[model samples]
Every structure is written in structure tokens, then in C-alpha cells.
Target: MSPESLRGWVKRDRIDRGEGGPGELTSAEREELTRLRRQNAEQRKTIEILKKAAAFFARDSDR
Candidate 1:
């Protein structure tokens, strides 16, 4: 691996082990945050689709 990449991994490992500093996220926290962000994006898309469907039905019923 490149030196920079290896250095980053070592830094992250230190942070995960609580040896680096305070307020740094552990690996599990990072994974959970990524998962939550993906889920939030999916929910937003679903809400948009539902809103469009509702508007379509509303206009159709008025005809």
C-alpha cells in the first residue's frame, strides 16, 4: 500500500482504539453513520415519490 494510505489506516486505528484523541469516531460509529445516511437518502426519495403520486391522483380525481 502507499505510505499515505497506510498512515491513514494507522491513524484511524489509533482513533478507534481511543489512543489518538477525544471526539473522534470509532470504526463502528463511522459504519453506522454511513448506513444511516444511506437510509435517510432512501427515505427522502420515497417521500418524494409519494408526494408526486398524491399530486397525480389529486388532479385525476378533479377531472
Candidate 2:
């Protein structure tokens, strides 16, 4: 495909034709995405802590 066509294809495939995919994010949307990502990271950390605690207790009980 030509460069122009390839760019169009990439935009369509990766960003869904600028319909709010990776290549397109407004300032407000970017902030929201950052906040959501932080929330997700915090949640994952909490889950890991809980899992470790559970494993520790389970192991102690097995002895």
C-alpha cells in the first residue's frame, strides 16, 4: 500500500478511525485515563498484599 493508505489503515486499525483509541485522547480524557490507571495499580497492589497474607496464613496452619 502507499504511505498515505498505510497511514489511513494504521489510524483505522489502531485508533478506530479516531474514535477514541490509543492514538486519540483529549486532555480531559487523558487525565481521566491517568486516574483510572492509578486506581487500577492501587487495586492490584491491594490484591497482591491480600494474596500474600492469605498464603502466609495458610502455610502457618499447615505446620
Candidate 2 pairs with clashing backbones:
none
Q: TM-score of the candidate numbered 2? A: 0.59
Residue 10 lDDT, candidate 2, scale 0-100: 66
Residue 18, model 1, lDDT: 83
Model 1, position 32: C-alpha lDDT score: 100
- For model 1, the stretches where C-alpha displacement exceeds 4 angstroms are 1-6
Best candidate, lDDT: 1
What lDDT score belongs to each candidate, Candidate 1 first? 0.94, 0.80
Please report, as a residue range, the 10-residue window in candidate 1 with the lowest summed lDDT.
15-24
Q: In model 2, which regions exceed 4 Å deviation?
A: 1-22
